[model samples]
Target: MKTLFSLFIALLFSMVAMAKDTDTRYYEMRIYYCHPGKLPDLLTRFRNHTTKIFERHGMTNVGYWVPVDNKDNALYYVLSYPSKEARDASWKAFGSDPEWKTVATESEKNGKIVAKVVSVFMNLTDFSPAVKAQAKNPERVFELRTYTAAPDKLNDLLSRFRNHTFKLFKKHGMTNVAYWTTIEKDGAQPKLVYILAHKSEEAGKASFEAFRKDMKWVKARDESEKNGKLTEKVESMYMTPTDFSTIK
Candidate 1:
């Protein structure tokens, strides 16, 4: 009986260790505009108002982007936290804050700032190795990718990329990851947005080499490509989170 109990404790420890290996916190937002041409105005407002509102409430801005080239017309951003509870509570308070309400209302006087928005919550999978203890600090090198897919191909593309490639990435030390797709809505083009965290630009450059060489990812990507058109187009950008000066 003692031996059996020892085995059970050992198994539990293994599971806990594996969980820590991939533990990461991520938050995603999709900001859909009333018109594509209005992006410049909206971005200015976001930089001036929205980011400050979030910071006051405890959210750490991870990265932000506008569509440089893509079918989807939206401004997507990512934020990170120590846990989901904090994310939920912070947003809840921010939403009700008088300051945020006033700013959001005032920003749209010229025109509608956002026609719609979507929020998604996710955690990194168990295979991802932890980032160095230091990368947990607020400032780090990161990039955001928004891969827009045709409605018909959305599910298949998600299954391949999210379930397959993402898992493989975690095993290769791509930790503290965040990924999500926009909720289906009229005029809303579906997109998969994810943030990649790295210690430096050089680290980001080198880390992907491992993922690129993964045999399973290569085969799966090729298979998806051959099966049919999985993506109409992909829009990706490398961006750093805004600093105090940029936000100001």
Candidate 2:
């Protein structure tokens, strides 16, 4: 019996090791700014073809969304890869796929679908909750927030989020989706980007108001800024998941 128990313990350890090996994933956030009056065409292409092609090349589709306000004619999506090396290879293959080439050429026969493409590579922060595609609540409203840190203050900003802000956010009924720092190779600014899920737009506003008024948060923000402000500006957008979005 002791020997059997010992074997079971070794097997458990092996399984744990394997799980850890596969836990580190890299993500890419892509914003495709479609040409005026061509937003539907861009979304159609992804819904009908691009996402399948991505899966064929081993990319995991995390989510796809369109901003509720629609001010920029943009589509936002996230893709996950097993590793940075895997991401690079997958993209190279995806771009070279014959089906993709045909689809892109046909989609652009009238006019170019996209005006600009902004891509950011990101690694999940230590404190980020695991985001599962199947677990997302369809009724939840997702808020994407980007914070541009003041020069040389990116670390301070991260520290605040890691140590204080996230906790306060939860206390006020915010659901942390995921957090990431832009990859250096992507030439992204010194910024922190994260998504939060709220029960509704009204709930989102109420949560922020409560969070801002919390004494702990007020104290933390004041103390952190004693040296200098950590962020220069913050951009926020509320998004709704598309019908085919994996997360929604």
Candidate 3:
């Protein structure tokens, strides 16, 4: 029993390390909730100054978007760093930069621009494509999806997506942008988050409806869940790229 327990410990750490892979780039997703009627000011600041400061601090700006409904007055964006340590360092520098401080103060002169902020750090999955900026496209809509894995079933969930779901999504007219798993500090539970692009919100919904009915997907999902369901919950949001977004 002692030997068996030791092997189990080793395997658990191995899996965690494989998922984190701190040596590689680490990504952060941030949502800024602006004060009512203050969102436009926040966007202007980011467009004119914040993005440049981020680049100066060695952060890679991935994409920025706002929800179609705008019900939450939130701005969502993703940033990447060379490594976990680099991410921390860059954020520290960004917070203290004189220009950033000035810009923040200026943007909020009328009133506090942001009411709240949420951030989640993540590691890119092996199956994720390299995220890159695209030429501006006014017609594209992006969907962000989050899936929570069932207890001790994270591997099974990842395997299913790796082996099957990714392909089916593209086949159904979805463009796989990137896939990530939240770092333990940010994700108390095992979870997967990914982005997909479609021609429009209508197109995105239609793609998923078709994807669900595909026999190949139905078979793969059933086979992967022989032990039990792989996910506990799923959340999806449709967003349009901001005019200044790099991924637009």
Candidate topping lDDT: 3
Candidate 1: tens digits of C-alpha lDDT, residues 39-89: 666677777887788888888775565443434557666565677788889
Cα misplacement distance, residue 228 of candidate 3 (Å): 0.9
TM-score, structure 2 vs. true = 0.85
TM-score of each: 0.50, 0.85, 0.88
Top-TM-score structure, candidate number? 3
Task: Give the true-structure RMSD of model 1.
Answer: 7.2
What are the runs in model 3 whose C-alpha is more than 4 Å off?
A: 1-23
Please provide, for model 2 over 1-248, each residue's C-alpha lDDT reduced to its tens digit, 9 standing for 90 to 100: 99999999999999998678544798899999998999999989999999999999999999998999998999999999989899999999999999999999999999999999999888777778776775457888889999889988888888899999999999999988889887875555656889998988889999999999999999999998999899999999999888889876
Instruction: Supply candidate 3's per-residue lDDT for 58.
Output: 100
Model 3 score (lDDT):
0.91
- Please state every model's RMSD to the true fold in angstroms: 7.2, 4.2, 7.0
Model 1 stretches astray by more than 4 angstroms: 1-26, 34-36, 70-73, 81-86, 128-248
Clashing pairs for model 1 are 128-170
Q: Candidate 1 at residue 43, lDDT?
A: 72
